[model samples]
Target: MKRFFQSIISSNSVALRTRGLLLLSLLLITTTFNASATCVRKDFSDSGGDLYGTSLRLGNINLTSDDLQPVGTVLATSVVNLFPSVGLTNPDTVMFECDLADANNIYQAFATNGDSNVGGFTNFGDNYFQTFFRYTALKLTNVESGVEFTRIWQKVPITHYATVGNKIQIRGRDFSPIRAELIKTDKYDPTPATNSFGCPGPSAIGYTGNYTCPQPNGYVAFSGPGVELEELGHDANLDWTSWGLVRYYALGMNLGPVSTLTNNNTCGVVSTTPLVTFAKISPAELTAGGNRTGSFNVQIKCQDGVESGVQHGQTSIAIQTSMPAYVAAQKINLVNGSGGVSYLLSDGYGTDSSVATGVGIRLEDSKGVTRYFTGWAPCDSTCASSDNSGWYPVLSNADSVGESGGYTTYESTYTAILEAIPGQTPKAGKVDATAYVLVKVQ
Candidate 1:
C-alpha cells in the first residue's frame, strides 16, 4: 500500500508542474499579441483594397543647410564682396542648383542696402547701384528628352533697399530691398524682361489663359515701350534663368525663405572691419613762456556693412596724453628732458575759449564741442585736481554722431604753453608729448 501511494503522489506532482509550464507559455503569447496590436505597420496594410504596399517618397536637395544659407538668407554679418560701384559686377559669384521636380515654379531674388537709400559701400544712390545674377547652366535631367537652357544676365540693377544684419530703425534714412523674379519661361522667349514677373499678363504679347501665349510664328514679345520681338517660342521647352529685377526700401524685413528653393534671403552678413587709426599728428616746437599749438586726427572707417544698430551716435572716442610735462608742487618735469620746468597743455588756445589755460588737455569733436582732460590737470572744474589724471572724452554725453561713406575722421587740436611760476625758470629744450586716442562702440 505504501509503494502504490508513493507512485501515485510522484505522478500527480509531475502532472501539476507540466500544467504550470503550459499556462506560462500561454501568458507570454497573449502579452506579445497585445503589444503587437498597439503598433500596426500601415505601410503594408490591405485596407486600401490592394495587397501591394503604397508608394513611398523621399526627396532631398543636393545642398546642405549651411550651403543654402549663403545663397539665400541674410545674417548679421551678411556682407557680400559685391559690386564695387554702380554698373560694376560682383567680384564673387554665388551658385545654386534647381531640381527638375521644381520646374515651372516661380522664385524671387532680392538684395537690400539695409538703409533708406539704395546706397552701396560708397553711399551712392540706388539709381546707380546694380546687382547682377545669372545661372551658368540649367538642366532638367529627369525627363528622357531633358530640357536644357541658359539665361545669362551681365548685370541687373538693384532698386530695393535690403539689409542682411539687424534691421534699421531710422526713418527715411533706410535702404530699399530689390526683388527679381525667377520665372520658368517657355523657349518662346528665352530671355525675360528686366523686371519680368512671368508672362501671359494683360500686357504680354500672347494673351491667353494659363501662361500659354500663342504667338504667331513663335515670336515672343519683349517688355518696354514699343512692340519688340525678342525670341521664338518652342513646345515643351523650359527656361530656368529668366529673371526680373525691382527695387524698394523698408524699415524692416521678415527673415524667412524668399523662394521655395532657398531657405532665406539674408546671408553673407560680412563686416567690413570697424577700425580707427591715427591719420596725422603734427609735431610741436614750444618757446619759453610762449605757447605751441598742434593738431592730430583720428580716422574712423565705419563701412557700409556696419550693423544698423551701430550708428555714429553709439560710438565713443577718448583721448589721453602721456603726461609729457608733469608738474608736482609748482615743479614741472619734462618727459624727454631733466629739470622741473613750469609748463602746461590746454585744449584752449584763444582768449575766448572756456577751457582754462594750464589744463591737462582739451579734446574736441567735429562740432567744436570741447571736454577737459584729466591727464595732467588742476586748472578747471572738468580737470582732476590730483596728478592721477584720466582720458578726456571727445563726445559729450548729449552728443550724437552720424556716419558717411568710406571714412569719417575726427581732429583734436591742442596748445602747449609754458607759464613760468614763481621761482621757476623756463627750460630751453624740446617739449615733446605723446597722446593716445581710443574708440569704442556702445
Candidate 2:
C-alpha cells in the first residue's frame, strides 16, 4: 500500500518563498511663500549674517522665511509586519489536533500491548505515517504574493497512547498547548524581559514559562514532556501513565526515536504512463516524397481521486513537452539503434496541419468537453483570455488545479498523432523525444 506521505514529502522539499514588496508611499511636500521686501542674497562662504529679503537668493535658488524652520520633525517610523499572516486554511483558530493513520498494521509496528501482530515498540521516525503526530500538513500561503510559505509544521510528538486488554492502541486526542520554536518573528522582542502573558523568556527556543501568551504569535516552542517522543526505535509502548494532561509550555530540543529519514515501503503507483511502445516507428522515406502519419495513446489515470482528511484535498495532473520540436542526428538524436526521424504531435484525429497548431494537445473531461493543452484563460465562471502558458490543468477532478475533491480516481486517454514533415530529408538514426507529466494534490 503506497501512502500519499512520500508524495507530499517530495512536494514539500521544494521551498516556497512568497516575495512581497511592501511599498511605503511618502507624502509629497509643496510650499509657497509671499514676499513683502526686495530680495537680497547672502553667501555663507564670505559671511554669516541675516539677509534682509522677502525671498533670499541663497546662491542656487530663492528661499522664503516660511521655507526655513529652526527645528522640524526629523524622523517618523511605523511598525510593519514582515511575515504575512499565515495559519490553517480551513480553520481560523490557532490550535488543532492531527489524527494518525487508522491502518492497524502501521500502529501495530510500535504498539506495545503485546498483540500478536505487534512487531515491537518503535518511535515514529521521519517518513513514518505518524511523524509529527499525524498532523495534517498545514498549507500556509500568502494570498497576495501567491507563494506558500513552509508547511506550518516540521515535526510533532505522540501526545497520548493507551492499552486495551492485551492489545495496545493509539488514540487520537487533542495535543493542545503545543508550540513550535520561534525562529524569526516580528512580534515582541526575540529576547523578551517578560512576555505579553507576564511570563519570563526561556533560555532556549523550546523552554517553558508559567503563563500562556496573551496574544499568540501563531507559533510556540514544544515545551512539554513530549520530548521523550523523539527517542530512537522504542523499547516499550508504555501507557499514558505519568504524562498527565497538565497543559504547560516547554520546548523539546531533540525529537526522540524519529531520527533519520527512512525510505521503507513508501513507493506509490505509476498512475500515468505511455500505453504503447514507440519502439520501431517506420522510417520517413524522404526519397518517397510524402508526409508520414502515426498515433500513440497516453494513459492518464488518477489512481486516487482526492486526498482524504486534509482540508484542501484536490488533485490535478499537468503536462508539458520537453522540447518544442523533435530532431535527429547532431540536431536529430537517435533512439538506441533506430534511424532518426523528425516528428510533431497534434490533437486532431484525421488529416491536419502540425505546423499551424504547434504540437497541439487536448484534454476531454468526463463530459467530453475538449480543452486545448497549450494554455487556458484565467477565470472562474467567466474566463479572461491571456498569453500565460504552463501551470494549467490537463486532468483534474476539481474545476481548478488548486481546488479539493473527495476520494476518487479518474482515468482518461489522450491521443498523440505524430506526423513526419514532408520534403525534409530524414536522418538515418534513432528518433526520440521527451514529455514531462506532473501530479499535484492540494
TM-score winner = 2
Task: Tell me the TM-score of model 1.
Answer: 0.20
List TM-score per model, in order.
Answer: 0.20, 0.23
Cα displacement (Å) at residue 392, model 1: 5.3
Model 1: per-residue lDDT, tens digit, 1-442?
0001124334587888987898899999778766533211111111111111111000001111233122332111111111211221221211112223222221222222211111111111211211111110111110111221112111121222222233211111111111111111112223333222222211233221121111100000111111111222311122211111111111011111111121211111112222222222222221133333334444333333222121222333334343323322223332122111223343222222442323222344345554333332211211111212222332332222344443232333333322333233333323233444433221
Give candidate 1's whole-model lDDT.
0.23
What is the TM-score of candidate 2? 0.23
CA deviation > 4 Å runs, candidate 2: 1-270, 278-315, 323-406, 421-426
lDDT of 1 at 116: 13
Clashes of 1: 36
